[model samples]
Target: MGELIVIRHAQASFGSDDYDRLSDLGHQQAELVGAALRDMGWVPDRLITGTLARQKQTLRGMGFDKAPEEHAGWNEYDFHDLLRVKFGGTIPDPVQHDRKTHFRTLRDVLREWQGGGVEGARETWTQFSARIASARQAATREGAERVLVISSGGAIGQLTASALGAAPEQMIALNLQVKNTAISRFIFTPRAFFLHEFNATPHFAPKERAHLLSYS
Candidate 1:
């Protein structure tokens, strides 16, 4: 079976303007993940990432000079658009408040979107899920044994939920828990892909890099 390694993009400029750019720490996290992957004796046969700057930057930061094939299907849903549509152009700022409240608000928005409540969403939840499935098919394409996909948390979470045949709400848990540069593994056969692991960050050992672990 071909193995697919899904890496969530490294930490972006969290709480900063232009959240699509990778922070200095994000670069460091990527390097660590790259080194850890090499240490595990795994080199990707193929590299894939979304068109997003953050996703591409994370791939570059991973110390691979090779160019990756861009897959827009792996691109994340636009949170700003979702919120604006859901709330009639009023986008809420969660950073000004507490963590619990921030997460609660995001979960609510996802729930609304999943239930088709987001009034003007360009891509429905079904569309997003279908996109993820397309990406998976491409990942397991012939001649690609060890495939690496660098994408955002939401897209990865959607992929995970779809793989497990879980309920829509379960995706919120995957989204909330995925860490920056985290590696989710799957064994891909011609028929289906089995989840080997989800949200594993072997690179960031608690004793050495506890502070570097970031969810955003």
Candidate 2:
């Protein structure tokens, strides 16, 4: 058996011009996560990340300088694009920055996208699940004892849900719980993969690093 550590990218510049870039606090979050890993004496035998800029930047901020094996399978659905597809040209600009409105919009967008509302979207839920499964299979086949993956919440959530035999709605719930730079762990064997933990934020425990928490 081997261990798979999945990390969600740190907080991006949400509601800003560039949503794919990390915020200042996000950099600090990444550094703290890296330091926590170092403190725990954890070093990955293999590293993987999605093609997204935030994903790559989070890994770099965590002090893993060398380029990771990039995989499009780990990429997230484009929420903005999906919204455009669902609402056509009527989508309103995100001006309020209210957390409730932001997440409400995200949820509605995801629901619509999952229901085949998005046009020109590359992957469906089924296709996305299969790709992530294939990625996991390939990674485990390499016989690495410890592997680290930096990916988005949706990908990680779907992978975890599939591994645990959860329903699609459960997967969506799991995705929502994932915090920026949070870690989820899995124990993998040749025959199966078991989730050990999900959405863990020990790197920024409230008592120790309260200042590091940032939703956006």
Candidate 3:
């Protein structure tokens, strides 16, 4: 069976003015993940990444020299926008900068968004799920024996949950747990797609490197 290796992009500049770029630690995490994958001989026959800068940067840090095919479907939902929309055009200060409060609010907002409670959301829950499905179809195409994809935590969580026929709430749980630079794998054929692994972070298994593991 063909294999698809999906990697969530490394630590982004959370709470910074720009959250789309990877942080210094994120770069290190990406490089370590790349080295670990290489040691396992899990090189990809094809590479794909979202249009986001963070996704592209993660792929580059992975040390793969090939040009990756860009897919917007792999991009993350606009959480900042969602927060603003949910709050009637202005994000609360706590949600804007405090990690705990931000995620707490996010969880509630996601539930609302899923149930069509968050008005003016740029993309509805249905649309977001549909795009992920479309991206999976593209990634699982017959030509490549092994495909590597660089995406965000939200997209990865949604995809995995969808693959398992799990509830949307499970996606939020999975999304929160996915560490930066974590890897998830899938085995696929034209008509079959199975989750082989989820959120494996062998690179950070060493005690010294354990401190490097991060989510958000």
Ranking of all candidate structures by their TM-score, best first? 3, 1, 2
lDDT measured at residue 18 in model 2 versus the true structure, 0 to 100:
82
True-structure lDDT of candidate 1: 0.87
What would you estimate as the lDDT of candidate 2? 0.80
Candidate 3: where are CA atoms >4 Å away? Answer: none
When sorted by lDDT, best at the front, the candidate numbers are: 3, 1, 2
Query: Which lDDT tens digits does candidate 1 get at residues 1-216?
Result: 899999999988765658798999899999999999999999998999999999999888888766789999999888767867766776556622345766677788899889988877899988988899888898789998999999989998988988899999999899999999999999988887889999999888867798899988
lDDT (10s digit) by residue, model 2, range 61-131: 89875558988888876666666656665457652256677678877667666666665655665676788
Full-model lDDT, candidate 3: 0.93
Selected candidate, larger lDDT, 1 vs 2? 1
Error of 1 at 204 (Å): 0.7
Model 2: runs farther than 4 Å from truth?
95-97, 206-208
Q: Cα-based RMSD of the predictions, in order?
A: 1.5, 1.9, 0.7
